[model samples]
Target: MTKQQQDEPPILPEEAVADDSASIGGSSTSESQASLRSSILDYRRENGRTYHRMSDGKYAFPNDAREQERLDTVNYVWMLTLDGDFCLCPKNDISAKRVLDIGTGTGVWALDYADAHPETSVQGVDLSPIQSTYVPPNCYFEVDDLEKEWTWSTPFDFIFCRDMNGSFADWEGVIAQAYKNLEPGGYLEIQDSIWPPVCDDGTLKEDSALYKWSHLLIEACDIIGRPINQTNKRPAMMEAAGFEEIKTTRVRFPISPWPKDQKLKEVGTANQVQLVHGLEALTLGLFTRVLDWTKEEAMVMCLEVRKDLKNLKIHAYWNGYVVYGRKPLSSEDK
Candidate 1:
């Protein structure tokens, strides 16, 4: 989920707006009839105005300086958690083959994969069409909505999903779909952070701000049927979705750089840097008007909010569960 766009400059309003690059009074409501999508979208919302959309279905970092900082934090910190081993094996595990990078934000991971494995072909998909249109001969981008149905021509040897905590509604559905799309003996990897659940002094309490914040966010998503708080039981869900040989790893990152090991300490610092700026955006980005918080209160609370990320001993982390399985090989291989 790492990005390099301008931090959103406004707050938010619900509902999609018209593509004014087109004619007026012309069928804004008709999803089927829309002629073209905007190349550089800059639209107005209740909070003020917003710019080109990102994958989460809204123009985040909208209008507020603090919000952009928060998002940049989340994006960069999560990138740190992408351990090297996670990227290393798939190449050797399978012969040079086609791959899928689900939710390929900014197309960083996909590009990295392409660079590492020259023989493999990679396809990256996102809602915003924000990926660079120009790519290696083996890499391509498609603006497909994963929430709906996905139809790819070829079965893939590897599929990757990451940092989609704020974007997807049907986590299991998407996982199952990945299972369906994978070739037998192929592999799939999913990585996401556990949002809003804080570990206080290495213990997660029910009432901590992280916990409370998480609950509110879940409720907000429940209202719209697009909730994203499903982190704890991902392994079992994957099994149910038909993935086998699932491997789950929980890496507890310091919310704000507080690890004893030098290597891990660097990770903590990265998480902390992101934490300082992500507080306002994560707290109010979706919940303010949608959840209705006063602008003054959100700003005030955020000052103290990021401090929580610094309690290194507090053991705050966005747990990444990478559960992958092999599609059953055919009788011939067996």
Candidate 2:
């Protein structure tokens, strides 16, 4: 593992410094509980899609049913990338006490983990209340933003975050908060794909719409204040947050089923499906709102990008990173 140079620290947004109030708690009477549920279900509709109303414009992706399906598909792709492992960290390190899943969209990972380890209590937190009601008894869901201060009464033994590429304005602050909210000798694992994908062969030409779309999405996310290329810099950030035994693994996720290896072909096939399903969800808002592109124009661009993604000739792939670190044990424990 090569040491990574830290990028310039991002400025914390003023809006992100609020209290870590959870949306699941604080309702006393039944009437107030019903009112809270109503407010939480009040989603913002845009361009035929729905997003979380609590932190409007905070996350770029949609939270509607279509996006939820795409998220589940993406989860499968990540699991394939990990050879069906739920996590890449040392299995022994994850305590059977408390596990926290940050940005747990749809709560699939949390629910699965809870079902697998019945002894462990799992909590999934997200800005959207789109998780299903029929979840494992040990699993819980909450609507909360992680950028704010964390107020959980107990520290987590394992904290997991995945695919939160463009979800935070202050990545460092969130990592520090995770460190603070972790039990000593706990583990924090983050799995994310590096964006603006790289191509080894010349097949992914610069003139390709796929190439242009990738870079434009990065630029749009940057203009909107949540750059998606933060995956590569997370190790250094984790190190700076006083985490020890940091480990990072980068795997190539092919754009199409063009790989000769059977394993890579399977990964590529799943990735292609999710990418095709996610193009509009990932691009529509950014293109129309941030880049000043019209709705029709954005749709056309997505169409063009779809064509490029379907072309098996383009040897395009993203570098998927799974980074994990251990919060140091206290002096007496050592």
Candidate 3:
């Protein structure tokens, strides 16, 4: 309690003392584990953008601030497309007690769902821990790979996935896993966009930059073993996974503000905004890493695509698919 003794340096813990000693000689077991964790947290920098290091080459998209803002914009675009609805699953179908959000990028949808359904306990899983720290008491996040074996012991009542078209190599496997992890009669909802958008009015020419961009993106994803054009094949996949009462809904997501309808125009405008910010983030990694293109070449291609996006003459639109299905009530039904 003396002043002299109080001012003296406090004795270090045994572990801390050992750590210091190890630092002077070599890396200890604790230090090695800490280093490995640090590497997982450390984002990888490529072509002036930062990407997730946990699943290094799995998802070819940036996880930095700019990309996060673009993702939020995409969320707004989907909201507008869905007429302000967060999901298409019927309220009566959801148990509202247990919910799982797969590939929750920023945890926005999970947080919103948890806030709206106070009784729901929501768990969002992603490869990166870039989600907001401040979350609803009923909602939390975990950093894990869904492609790996799921270790959750409890079954989820409702499992949801969105905007994950090109993020997986085996869609059927993921669907099977969801079916296995869901409670009997539980629901699984997936929302994704059809890639290589179609044009009905013949305005999207084959030589157009936007058209070329879409096809090239598809090719890149295919080469990387994660095809993005699997929206139409989801229903059959769900059915194969022993799901019943499957429902499929498609909405028009225009590329520009060229639609005559008021709501369509609004959705188009939001889509344009998202494309403006997302063009580079979406293409840079795939082009540079998968397609073996130079960074400048990729930027030029993005510039051309952006120009085409603003032309307003092309009537191109991606088909937004919202597919949901319910698990069978019993083993006999399954």
Candidate 2 residue lDDT tens string, 1-334: 1232122221111121112444453344668667767877899888888888876789988999999999999898888888878898864334458999999999899888888888889999999988887877788888887877788989888999999999998998999988888889888999998888766556788898998999999999899788898788999999989899999887778887877667878888999998898899998889888999988998898999999888877777887789999999871221
Model 3 residue 6 lDDT score: 50
Q: Name the regions of candidate 3 deviating beyond 4 angstroms.
A: 1-37, 92-95, 332-334
* CA lDDT, candidate 1, residue 267: 68
Best by TM-score: 2
Estimated TM-score for each candidate: 0.74, 0.90, 0.88
Candidate 2 Cα misplacement greater than 4 A, ranges: 1-28, 92-95, 331-334
> What are the per-residue Cα lDDT tens digits for candidate 3 across 1-334?
2252255332211122111111111234686756755776799999999998876879899899998888888888888888878889874334468898999898888888898888889888877767887887888887777888777888987999999989999999999999998988789999999888877657789999998889999999999899998788999999999999999887778887777677888888999998988899999999999889999999999999999888777777887789999898884322
Assess each prediction's global lDDT (C-alpha) against the native: 0.59, 0.82, 0.82
Q: Tell me the lDDT of model 1 at 286.
A: 61
Q: Tell me the tens digit of each residue's lDDT in model 1 across 1-334.
A: 2131123221111123111122212235655435344432333343442423424344333433443344445555556665454343355345448888887756767776787777889877765445555577778766556777667757888888876765666778888888778888788777776655544344445655555666777777666565566665677777787667777765556554444455556667877776675665555656675678776776666765555555444555554555566666751221
The per-residue C-alpha lDDT of model 3 at residue 65 equals 92
